[model samples]
Target: MQSIVLLLWLALCAEQDVRERQIANTLTLGVGLCALIFLFVTGHTWIGSDAEEAGWALAFVILLTIPGYMLGQFGAGDVKLLAALALATDRQYLLGTIIGSGVALVLWLLSRRWLWSLLSQKVKNRLKAWGDESSKKQPFAPFLLAGFLLASVWIH
Candidate 1:
């Protein structure tokens, strides 16, 4: 189950990185639906046996991410993906995922800024001119994926 989720997450990250910064509804919603079905059939989520924990996770993620979504700080796909992951993850591990994602995002932003500062003014101008609009917005899926992996390892 973990392996399958990891593969799907990797695909999502790849799609977000290589294509436009949009996540497919098929992947996000499909995983969510599958997690729901798995919970019904097995009385367990991907990471735990407690259905209530999954429910809480789902609710928590929705509530937490909705404001960001509303403010346009997060894309709809990013919120959906996080909500789906919350459903599949144990509540305890969800904290790790959230924290890890925040840390990763901060580090990525800082590193990118640092790297940009290192480039010559002419190079920066040329690169900025060549860069597409999509490059300006960092994709969240990869950071989320990294967080998920970190949580998985930390918990196990």
Candidate 2:
């Protein structure tokens, strides 16, 4: 039930980010809250051992995300998405989520050449380049969402 809802919400958020390159605060907040509730209900905790477990899981997510965020590999939304999942799910789910994100990261890196071409085309046409946070271009949300959605199958 909670897993299904989280998966749906993750998919929706990923679509929204992929389409617009911006994740809505409402969606982020809603998803985070839902995950937290899921954790609590499962005895995972937002305030106790579960909370500590979540903290550890979140730390792992952060370890993966920080490099991406710093190296211009991913956006803040991606990191936040992982953090939200850490808050919402149990350690098992959280670890699975990390593995999923890692898979997404690999996919994104493998597709880097295409990303460069896309950026070059946009720049060559002098089109309004969106989400241009770094000098290098990035494929923002697709992979992160892919990871979350894929790993979510383990939840049930």
Candidate 3:
């Protein structure tokens, strides 16, 4: 199950990185629906056996992220992705995932300057076309993937 989630995250990261930073609804919603079905069929979730925990996790993620969504700080796809992940993760580990994402973002921000200098001219030009240095926006799925991996390791 964890491997499947990792593969899904990898797909999302690839899409966000290579494409226009848009996440497909089919992927996000399909993952969420599958998670719900898994919980129903197995009486288990990443958090526990309770289906209510999954519901609360979904609600918590929505409540937590909706403000950012409304403020345009986050795209709809990012919020949906978080919500789907919430349904699949334990509440305790979910907090760790969120914190890990922040840590990953900070690390990337600090390292990107040095890393940028090492990139080939063509790659640099392409990255520049993706976004300017001043913009805070960048593909976030990678950070999410890092966080998910970190939380998985830390908790288990």
lDDT of 1: 0.74
lDDT of 2 by residue, 21-98 (tens): 767867876677766776767766432346678877778878878998898777777778778877876567767766
Q: What lDDT does each candidate get?
A: 0.74, 0.67, 0.72
TM-scores for every predicted model: 0.79, 0.64, 0.81
Candidate 1: tens digits of C-alpha lDDT, residues 44-127: 888664888888888888888899888888888888887777777767767777888888878766676676778898877655
What lDDT, from 0 to 1, does candidate 3 have? 0.72
**Model 2, residue pairs in steric clash:** 35-88, 44-50
Better of 1 and 2 by lDDT: 1
Task: Judge candidate 2 against the unseen true structure and give its global Cα lDDT, from 0 to 1.
Answer: 0.67
On TM-score, the leading prediction is 3
* Candidate 1: pairs in clash: none
| lDDT per residue (tens digit) for residues 96-126 in model 3 | 7678888998997888888778899888766
Better of 2 and 3 by TM-score: 3
